[model samples]
Target chain A: MAPPEKIELKKQAQQLIEQYDNFLFDCDGVIWLDEKLIPGVLETIEHLESQGKRFAFVTNNSSKSRDTYIEKFHRLGFKGIGKHLIYPTCYAAASYLKEHLKVPAGAKVWVLGDHGIETELKELGYIPVGGSDPRLDDEFHPQHDLLKVDPDVRAVVVGSTKAFNYMRIATTLQYLLHENKSLPFIGTNIDRSYPGPEGLILPAGGSVVNYMSYTSNRDFIDVGKPSKRLLETILEQRDFDKSKTLMIGDTMYTDIKFGNDGQLGGESGGSLLVLSGGTKLKDLHHLIENPASLQDGPSLIPLKYIESFGHIIHLLSN
Target chain B: MAPPEKIELKKQAQQLIEQYDNFLFDCDGVIWLDEKLIPGVLETIEHLESQGKRFAFVTNNSSKSRDTYIEKFHRLGFKGIGKHLIYPTCYAAASYLKEHLKVPAGAKVWVLGDHGIETELKELGYIPVGGSDPRLDDEFHPQHDLLKVDPDVRAVVVGSTKAFNYMRIATTLQYLLHENKSLPFIGTNIDRSYPGPEGLILPAGGSVVNYMSYTSNRDFIDVGKPSKRLLETILEQRDFDKSKTLMIGDTMYTDIKFGNDGQLGGESGGSLLVLSGGTKLKDLHHLIENPASLQDGPSLIPLKYIESFGHIIHLLSN
Candidate 1:
C-alpha cells in the first residue's frame, strides 16, 4: 500500500545486477519507442550479454513474426540475441496451441489477427481460416457473403488488427454463441493501447478481444502478458533458475503482473519497471495520491525503477 | 408475484376494446410478417375503423422512411392509414435531434443506418454524412481511408444496417472517443434479432448499435421502442388522451416497457402484448416459475391477449 521506492540504476545497483542471471525484456516501451531504440538500451543488453547474462525480447505485438522481430533486433544493434530468444505473442499462441492446448495438426483455428498470427499457425501445422484473406478480411471485397460458422474451426484466436470489422466480429460471435458457447477463444494479448509512431497510441489487441467478449457475453484465453501462457512457454523451453530471472517491462500491469503470477508456477519471481514510455511517473503519483479512485487496477509495485532501460547499463558497470 | 391472468382474447373481450380509443400497433409481427398480412388482422383494423377507433404504426426499423412505409402500407391493402400516422425510429431520431438535442440546421450528423435515417435527417435540415454516401459507406470505394473525426459531426446515429461494417464503426468510434467522448450518441433501435423471411432471425439494428457502444465505451440514447422518444414524438404531434390510448405490440420487452415509461410524463399508459410473435407464454411461464433467472426483463403483461391480431376480429364480432 505504501509508495514503491524508486532507485536510480547507477547507485548501489551491483546487488540488483548480480541477483538476476536471466533478463526478460518487454519491447515496445522499455527497449524502444516505436521503431527507434531507447538511448543506451542496446548497449545495456550487449553489456549484460558480455557478463554472461541470458536475455529474451518479449513483445505482445502480434503483427510481426519471430523471424521479423529477430531482424529488428539486429537492426536495432541488440547483439547476441537470436530468433529463438525472441518471444512474441504470436509465437506464444502457436506454442500454446501445440504444447498446452495440444491441438492436433491440421485442426482448423479461426484467426482474427494479421499475417504474424497466420504465419505462426502455419508453422504449427494448424489450418487457419480468416485473418489474412482479402475476400474475408477486406470489407469491400466481392463475394463478401454472410459468415457461415465453419464447423471445422475448433478455436477462435484474436490479436491486434486494423481490419477488425463487423463481419469478423459477427462471424466470431456466432462461434462463441453457438450451442451455448462451447468453444475455445484465444487472444494474442489484451494490451489496451499499442504504442505507435510519433508517440501516438492506438487501440491494441486487448480492445479487439474485449469488444468481442463484451458483445458475445463470453470470456477468452489471452496468451500474451500479463497472461501466464507466455511465461509458461518460456520456462518450458529453457532451464533458468526462477529466482535469478527478472522480468523487466515498461508496464506495471503486464510485465510486473507476469512476474508475480509466474511465482505460482513454483519459483521466486522478480520484476523491474522501466519508465521510458507508456505509463509515466505522474500517473502512478495520481494513483498514489488517490488510491481509492479506482476499484480494480495495477496493484503491483515492481522491485527496481529506472528512467529507462538505458539506465540499467550503469548497474552492470560495477 | 402471481401469474398474470391469461384471457383468451376471443372468449369475452368487449370491455378490452372499449377502454382505449387510440390503438398504437407495432408492425412486423403484430400486423404482417414481411409482405403478407397476418390473416384476419386487416379485417380487425377495418372493423375498428368502422367503430371510430384510431391507430398508428410504430416500428424500430430505420431503413424505411415514412413515405416508403406508407407505400408498403398501401401495398398491403390498409386503406385507412396515412404517412402522418407512422412513427419509425428514424423519425424518432430526427425529432430527437430537432426537439431534444436541438442540433441546428446545416449541422452535420454522421449516420450509421441506411437511407431512411439519412432521408429523415435531410428533411430536418441537418447535413447527413456516412450512411448512404458512396465515398464513406462503400467498403470498395477508392479512398478507404482511416476515419478522421470531423469536428462538424454533432451526433452519430445508428440503426439497422446491412452495410454495418468496420469502416462505419471505426468512423463512429473516432467521433465518440474524441475530446474524451463528449458527443450525443443516438441509436435508432436496439432490437437484437430481426425476424427475416422463411422464419429466420438475423442480428438487427440493436446489434450494430451495441457493437459500436461496446467498442467506444460510451452509452447511447436509443430513440426507438423501449425508449420513450417514439411515444414522446406521438404526443407532440397529436392530441390523444393518455388514459384511453394503448400500445399494442408483439413483444413484451419493447412495447410494454414503452407504455410503462410513458407514465412518467404524467399519463396513464396501457399496453398489449401479442403472443403471435417473439416472446411466448412458455418463456414468461419459465421466468415466473424461476423468479430469478434474470434481474430485468419483460415484466409487463399487456391489458389484452390474443393469439394474433387476426384474432382481434373476434373481439369486434361482439
Candidate 2:
C-alpha cells in the first residue's frame, strides 16, 4: 500500500486547539527524542501558552519520574511543565495491584524500576525495596550488596532502568520463586521497544520481565497504558466529561486501541490518532483494510500529516 | 480449640472402601513431603494393593512432572504408581491462556517453574526456555540468560522453581513492563505458602509470582486448583460424569473447595477433605461455626477421613 498522503496534522491540531479548552500532548517522539527537543515543539507550546490553552504532557513511558521528565523538558527549553505532567506507569501499577491483586496498602515490595514506580507504590502504602537512584554510582548492579532478597519481601515490581543486568534479574527471580512463591511478580508496562538516541532500543522494564518469564517459566502482570489499569487511572485523574474529552496519541496499539472502549477507559471516551511517531503511515493502510487488525476503531480518522509543531502554530495563527 | 475427640477417620475410610469400587488419593502431605514419603504412607498403599482396590494419586501440585513424582514415589517405597497421577498446573495454565488471554499456540514464552509447566507449554506450542541440571557444573542458572526476552517472546509462564533468584525475577519484570507490555503474564497457582520438610516454606511457583507482584506492583492471572481455570481444564480434558467423579484432597483451600458447589469447581461434584495435612481438626469446628470462613461453604465437607493409607486399606479390606 502507498504511504498515507501527508495532510498537515499540525494544521488540524491547531484548529482543534481553537475549539478545545484543554490539550493533552504525548511525550517521547512527540516532544523530544533523548535530550534534544523536536523542532518547533517549544514554539508550539509557547504559542499554545500565549493563546491560553491548558496543556498536559501525557506519557506512557513509566521509567522516569515526573520530576525527571520535567527536568528533561526544562533542559530542552520547555518553560513551565510541572508535576501535573501525567505518566501512566506508576498510577497504572498502583491501581492494577489494588483492584486486581487486592494488594493492601503497606504491602512489602521489591522494586527494580525508577522513582516513578517506587513513589507510586509508596503512595499506595506498598513497602518498596531494592530500587536505587540510577544516577548514583553503580546502583544498578545486582551484586552481593544489592543481590539479597528480603524474606519478607511480598512482591517484585519491574519498570524501566538504565543499568539492568542478567545477574541482578536472575537474583531477583531466585528470591521470588524460592523464598516467597506466594508473592506476586508485576511489571508496570509492556511496550516492547522504546525510542532511544541511537534508534529503537530494548524496552527497559517490560522487556526484561518478559525475558525473565521465559527463563523462569513464570508470568507477570502489566499495569501501563493500553492496559485497563492505566485507562482507569487516567479516568480517575481527568474526571472530565467523557463525551467531550478526547485521548490523542501517535500509536495505534497503545493509544488509540486503549482509548474509546469500555474495556479500558469506558465506552464514552474517544481516541484520536496522530501521525507523528510509532504508527507509521504505511501501517494505517493495513489497519484500514483489516477490521480485526484494529481491535477497536479510532473515534476520528488520524490526522494524516505533520512536519513540526511550528506548522501547527502557523495554522492556528492564520 | 481442642482437637475433635479422635474421630476414627480410619473407620470412615474403611466404610467408604467397602462402598465404592474406585478410590482416589491426594499427594503432598498425604503421601509425601518433597522427596520423602509421609510417615506410615507405604503401609497404607500396600494394604490398598492387597485389597485389590482401584486407586489413583491426584494432586494439585503442578510444579513437578508426573514422571518426577512417580519416580519420587518409587524411591520412597511405593512402587508402580501409574501415569494416571493427575496434575492440575499445566492444564490450568494452558486452558486459561487459551480461553482468556487467547494467546496463540505458537507464541514464545519464558517458563519459570518445573518440567510440568515446561512440558505443558511446549505441548501448547509455546517456546520454552531455561533449565539445567544442578550437578552439571553449568551453574544451573538458565533464568539468568538475557536472550529469554527476545522480541519473539510473547508471554511469561510462572510455576514452581527451587533455584529462582532476585535477578531472574527483576529481569522478567523489566521485560514484561517495558519491552512486551502486551505479552501475557500468567501464574499457575496462587497458594500463599506450602508444606516443606522443615514445616511450611514458600509455595514455590504461584507463591513466588505473588510475592514479586507485591514488590513489582503488578497483577497476574492465576490458573490452578481452586481457581476457576482448573475446573474448566478438567471439564475440557474429559466428558466424565461430574456427579460420579469425587474430588479429594488433604487441603481445604484447593481440594475441598473444588467440590461441585465450590467457587470455581461448581456444584456437580463432591469433595472429601482429609485431615492428614493442611487443615487441622480444630479448623473444622471453626469452619462449621463460621461458614463465611469456608470460601466454598457447606457444599464442601469431609466426606471421609483416614489417618493414612493404612487406614484406607484397612477400611477397604474390612
Clashes in model 1: which pairs? A190-A206
**How much native contact recovery, as a fraction, does model 1 achieve?**
0.09
Candidate 1 CAPRI category:
incorrect
User: In order, what lDDT does every prediction score?
Assistant: 0.73, 0.58
How far does residue B247 in candidate 1 sit from its true spot (Å)?
4.6
Per-residue lDDT of candidate 1, residues B1-318 (tens digit): 334545465554565667778878889888887787888888888877888988788998888999889888889898757888999889889889999898899999988889899999999998888887676545532134546667888988988786765566656666777776787999888776644455533456777777677666568998999886678678667667667787878766677667666652134347776777665777556656765555554345444456777776865565
Q: Report the lDDT of model 1 for residue B76.
A: 86
Docking class of 2: incorrect
> TM-score of chain B, per candidate?
0.91, 0.74
lDDT string for model 2 (A19-98, tens) is 55445566766777666677666887787788865656667676776667777888888787777556647656765677
TM-score of each predicted structure versus truth: 0.77, 0.55
| Off by more than 4 A, model 2 | A1-11, A26-47, A58-62, A74-80, A83-247, A250-271, A274-318, B1-10, B35-40, B60-63, B82-246, B250-270, B275-318
Instruction: For model 1 chain A, give the 10-residue run with minimal summed lDDT.
Output: A137-146
